[model samples]
Target: MTTYTLNVVIDNKQLLLLKENCYTLCIAKKVRDQLGDKYNVVWKGTADFTQNNQFKWAEQYEVFALKSFKIGALVEAASKKEPIGHKQECIFNDSGVMEHAKADPNLGDDTFKVTNQYGATSFGISTILNGEHNTSYISPVIIKGHVVFAPVNDIRVWFALKLPTGTMFSDFTGEYVELQFGGDKTTVTVCYDDLGSWKLKDSNPGVVG
Candidate 1:
């Protein structure tokens, strides 16, 4: 069985996400600061991977997983070890949301790697996590790039920006008809904005709705 781990941030803290073995709809929302800053804020009421993870309860007032981790400690721990999540195309951005990535099949599994470490990108997050040799879901992606991933049946996607300084916002993971990506010489984009819109995570996480 292939196991996957996802990372998310809440209240300036980091946490890893995992599929639930129990609990149907009851969700968890922690007070990030009081929780010791070293926990994963996993939403208990998250929609199935096939559905849009977004819900409308009051826009910006919806509750979700609020795990918190000490940034300094996490970085230090990772540095002391081989790195917690350098394998599998799954990567966590500034929002602490995980995005599934893929490289060309012809390039081989070890071809794609995250940011260069020690002047070299660590090889094999995809290969290590995805030991499943049964099937493949290779879409038209490039340069060992990223693509928004949902459970095989989940159409769930983040709609609007979560928040400027927070983990979630009014816009939650919502449904869509299709998701696509493209790149040429200048830009490689997720085209999720066609469904809604968002700001560059590197440029700004966004403040207003």
Candidate 2:
């Protein structure tokens, strides 16, 4: 069977700085500079994505940054409460998913920064399919507590890789693709079934299995 893997890689240099002094604003700035401005590195603590799609618990001492992309317009529209007409629904089902998938071959590994109902910045993956977009699973790598207060000071990152359900191996142009995040790299193995439902596969920190 062909297997699909999704991997998350963290930048060690920046991670090291945070590990040295997670709470120090100066060190946080240095880390952010090294990681680039696009990432969501904050001096204040950040919230992790939850199953119920809520961000809770505000604590000091941990610092993190993330790079995320915006969801496609059609996918976004389908997700909202606004009424969708039959013609729009048909177009969405027939072409919406594939268009989004092809638009971003890196979709599996990239982070999508989404705002929840409460206006908190939550990290999660959005599905390309009509209803599935709302159900996409997101797992984030988080660093907790200050270096002084926390026993472990490690950087953990997680991203989701998804293919439209029933996508066959033959559907892709290549058997494998390599993805680079800063100085780190990861591989993803994908599997297919007749049901055509997207599958969520988790990978090791740097390796996908």
Candidate 3:
């Protein structure tokens, strides 16, 4: 299991619902330092996929409990020889990611960033995410990590991976749901491949930048 370390800064705010447990977090293989820096990331499966088509997102049964949730483990990661990223709006409110990665070759990285939880800069404001889960295609995959939701936080934010129905859970999972970001929607799908690469798709109609 290739341990995948990611710095999730709520890549988008339109998916974060702290009180509602609705979030969409994503991770890429490479981060650019300039406009033309090459970048890439492996795509993999996760512990938060949709059931049939009813939105089986990875929600914590209890946020403040002792029970823990398990996501998939990372397999591998590398930098791709692709063009740098474009200027996109960052949004992270009702969004949030996991697990074994599968390589799908090295592709270009075209992603945006936003956070309503207040910017990390001294010149930014702390915003809040109020958008609904109307996304079309958005899924994140990482590797090997353990985290507890509720029963551990003393709040209703239960972790430990639970399907929307509170039936089954896994070390890592995947989800296929659309989010209502501002006024757009896309069929987001995240997962890991068998070749040890991570996969992420923001296939919304002009949704993801």
- TM-score per candidate, in order? 0.17, 0.16, 0.17
Give the Å shift of residue 204 in candidate 3: 3.4
Which 10-residue span in candidate 3 carries the lowest summed lDDT?
Answer: 148-157
Highest lDDT model number: 1
What's the TM for model 3?
0.17
77-138 per-residue lDDT for model 3 (tens digits): 11111111222222222222111122222322233222222222100111111122211111
lDDT of 2 by residue, 1-209 (tens): 11112322224443344335432111001111112322112211222222212111111111111222133111112222222111121011222121111122322232211212222122222222212212122112221210111111111122222222211111112122222222232233222212322222434232212
lDDT of each: 0.22, 0.21, 0.21
The residue-level lDDT of candidate 3 at 66 comes to: 11
Model 1 scores a TM of 0.17
- Give candidate 2's error at residue 113 in angstroms: 3.1
- Name the regions of candidate 2 deviating beyond 4 angstroms: 1-112, 115-123, 129-134, 139-209
Question: What would the per-residue lDDT of candidate 1 be over residues 61-137, giving only the tens digit for each residue?
Answer: 11111122222111111221122221233343345333344343433322232322122111111112112211011
